[model samples]
Target chain A: MDERMTDAVLATEELTVRFGGHVAVDRVTCRFRAGELTAIVGPNGAGKTTYFNLISGQIPATGGRVLLGGRDVTRLSVAARTRLGVGRAFQLTNLFPDLSVLENVRLVIQSRRGRDFDMWSMAAAHADLAEAAEAVLERVRMTDLAGRKVAALSHGDQRKLEVAMLIALDPKVYMFDEPTAGMSVDEAPVVLELIAALKAQTDRTILLVEHKMDVIARLADRIIVLHNGALAADGPPREVIASDVVQEAYMGKALEDV
Target chain B: MLKRILSGDMPQSRALGLILLAILIGLAFAPFLFPGTRSLDTAARICVFVALAASYDLLLGYAGIVSFAHTMFFGLGAYGVALASDGMGRSFGALAAGSLAGALAAAALALLVGLFSLRVRAIFFAMITLAVASAVAVLFSQLSGITGGEDGLNYRIPRALTAAARYAEEPFLGMRLTGKVLNYYLVFFGALILFLALLRVVNSPFGRVLQAIRENEFRAEAIGCRVVWHRTAATVISAVSAALAGSLYAIWLRYVGPDTVLSFEIMVDILLMVVIGGMGTMYGAAVGAALFVLAQNYLQALMGAAAEAAAGVPGLPLILDPDRWLLWLGALFILSVYFFPTGVVGRLRGR
Candidate 1:
């Protein structure tokens, strides 16, 4: 962690979640700084996704609280958190399969701009909204597929669209849970490039939970390794990957395969 | 129509809207064109149901909520006018105030139900509404002093709306512009304006979010929509529209009864209207309501005569009996589901 960058954009104070007796996420505390790319990598059942869910307000916390920009947002709904700028891309492909790509992106932009409740106005009548939607599509290189339905898009392209939606939201903190989890070998890097471009494009803080090491190594400036449900190691990527604890517990033979 | 379709995102609705517009115009001049009591009555019923079914679609088709409490709100509106006119003297002001009261009450009930039950599973939401509606129906029936019990309520409307009253100067098509004619036009014009307003609502930005929520609630919520609130608003809007339809029905019939407006059969009729016409398609409601009302009026008589004529035949008696008309309707519904799986309008639009 940089000393001058002491202001935490997202912080979990002893965040805990348990499914009955099974502790999915056990008392984890960490601070994500502004404008830095952080990766949460671990073996399967590491509770990385659960941690993301807690912060994104996808699920209620059994214990502890979540803070964003130094404000307590633990009890807020997923939508409330989203309005306050916590954007999430799900592990599964979560785009609206029935709606057009442009519509999907436009809904995100509309939600962020608080125009979703405009019942009397035509959706296409707003020029600013259309321009904003088009701008996000251009940024994610999906302007060509704007008219196409989300279900018709390729897996890689759909992933890009999800990122495009987050961009439309213009969230201050982004939480991506295994964004490239289901992609083919060729398609994985294309998604990574899109996500990687997000860092350079905006000064938003990003936290991603990824299984693959190479993708994490390429994008994450800082890495947090998890074993079971607790943080095993947290530091600069080079130092964290070099630690004996991460090597012994989670990343031992995993790094070798990559 | 072409300009509206081009300006709106819902292209398929244009055809449905035009068809409904033509039907409304034809019904408005039914006395002039097709002069008969039965034809006039059927036309008036179509107007009432078009509003009811279309409002039901706001919840069922657009918001994707299955509510069985619709006719409860409908009955409340009829009773609202009947009771207010009876007590406050037969005046148009009293009728309008009563109908407005009914609409507001129904909206409040819908909001309360939505706030509590909308958070549950979809099927549970349906079951909760059905239970509440049944309870309200029972309450209306048992309160004989206020609701007139099983006999129902019959009260005089304003003098100009009474059956004998007529326009003294200009006769419409050699016939006096009687109260029935005035009532027919009232229902016709009222249903049209409300239906068009509903079309405007479903085509707006708010309606798009409703479609989104119907498609995927989790995704909708994650995208910053207040899902429960949206569902609640849909319920209120739908309830108010159904109540208005009920008011029209009461005024046209000059009577309000449990069997006529508050029964589960009426709810079933509304459901069939949406399903057969098509869910989520605004125009389908009008088509469905018109077809169903026409069949109910004409087919019952046709089937009864056929059954009476075929009384000597062995199996024909059982099959063609007027009471077994539901069996024929069931078969037709099944065939409709099979052939026009998306619905009449949905299929017409090639969706």
Candidate 2:
């Protein structure tokens, strides 16, 4: 990875998001470097998803600022943030169940292509849009299932389709939450390969929240550990995993349940 | 091949072309097949309800928000036309402006309601809308001066095509519209145009994001979809459609009243049409409307003799009356909920 790419694609300055009385994420500051795959690892309730939410502008931060390419976007709406080149994929699959895989990708591509409000022209006539969606499908290895309904796809394939959707947006930064949550051991490697390939091919920054340490160790260029809504450790995988606090956070009897 | 066609990957243009062709053929030949006052009247009524049903589907089916207050918008449009055109002697343009005013008013009301109610999901949202509808009905009943109260407002039929003919100096398209046939074609064609426009909107990127919001709002927001805006837009669009249907009803009946506009029956009928036809599918609205009208017509005919025979029982209300159709409609709703959860057409499509 280029050292200049570490100038930061997305950065948070003491960002805090509170839900009623409980603080979901507390004064967490971090920077996602461009062209690098960064992993946020923590147990359940550690606020990894909430942090993602704040960065993506899905939810407003109670305190501090979210900077995208050095521009403060704390008050921006989700769509506005998307327009600024932030793409997100949810932990649970969010594809339109009735629409086919190709249509799902086509919708994202259409939005990116800036023809969302075209009422008179037939969307099917946009051969370039279809080709763009097809390219994303091929990237995710979902070209074979493009014609199939998303509901008909297996759990792993659906995840790939979700990735395809994000790819169609061609966003500068991608935030994925639990990308391989329901995949089998055999299927997990395929997704890992896709993510690796995505990182190698594009200068886009990747922020991932994952539980599978092996997958994290394999893909993460840097790892940030969150425990109880605060950053516990930050460094390379070897350095962070060896920290006593990180081990205690994971191996503690009470924490083990999470 | 059928699976591929039904998969929604097939461009909507091709499917829409076939549907439009079918509708054009049907509209062209329908007058000759029906050739009678009763048949024409039924067909016109179907068109009116189809438009109303399609609007309701836009909200409940596609947007996944059940709004029982839809009939309030419909009623407002009817009353606006009555008050503006009939009461004030305004022209067709004024009537249209009045209808648009009513639609805007409904959109404002929906925005207010959605601000609080949209926070609640599912049955709670439904209850809130129902409360709004009931409250509106009560207000309309109490405000007799504006709504014409129970007696309703009766007036002359507004000249729809005659003005067009006079302006263009066309010979009324060679058909005397003094009968119901012309009204049927007019409403049917209007309904067709509205349906096509809605189909385009639903297939657009805007509609896809709205569906994504419906599926998972939080995720959609995370992905940069403005969930509130999309939902509100859907509500406003639905209100406009309902308002247009209301104006058409006022024109067709040559009357407007609190009973016609503010009735719980209209809301229930719209719900039945969307649910029984299919929720979410474009054609579900038309299918539901057709089935509902057909069932009502036949059921009333069948129950007339039975009600007459049972009239000697003294206290029993006439089951043959159109008002009594609610009971059967409620039964059908329950049946649809249990057996055909997705709707009749939805079940057939195996969705």
The number of the candidate with the highest DockQ is 1
Please provide, for model 2 over A39-88, each residue's C-alpha lDDT reduced to its tens digit, 9 standing for 90 to 100: 99888899999999888887889999999998999999887898799998
On the 0 to 100 scale, the lDDT of residue A47 in model 2 is 93
lDDT of 2 by residue, B1-351 (tens): 532232232323444345434644655555565555566566666777878888888888878888888999898778777777766673667567667777777778878777777767769988998899888888777777776677777765446533222333332445334534555566777766676666666665666666666776665554555567678778877787888788777766767777777798878888888988888876778778877876777666656666777777865545545467658766767887689888866666665
> Which residue runs of candidate 1 sit more than 4 Å off their true CA positions?
A1-6, A184-190, B1-22, B168-171, B304-318, B321-323
Candidate 2 chain B weakest ten by summed lDDT: B2-11
Candidate 2 scores an iRMS of 3.6
Binned by DockQ into CAPRI classes (incorrect, acceptable, medium, high), candidate 1 is medium
Error of 2 at B126 (Å): 3.6
Q: After superposition, how far is residue B113 of candidate 2 from its true place, in Å?
A: 4.7
Q: Write the per-residue lDDT of candidate 1 for residues A36-153, one digit (tens) a residue.
A: 8999998888899889989999889999889988899999999999888899888777878888999899888888888877877667787788899999898767789999988889
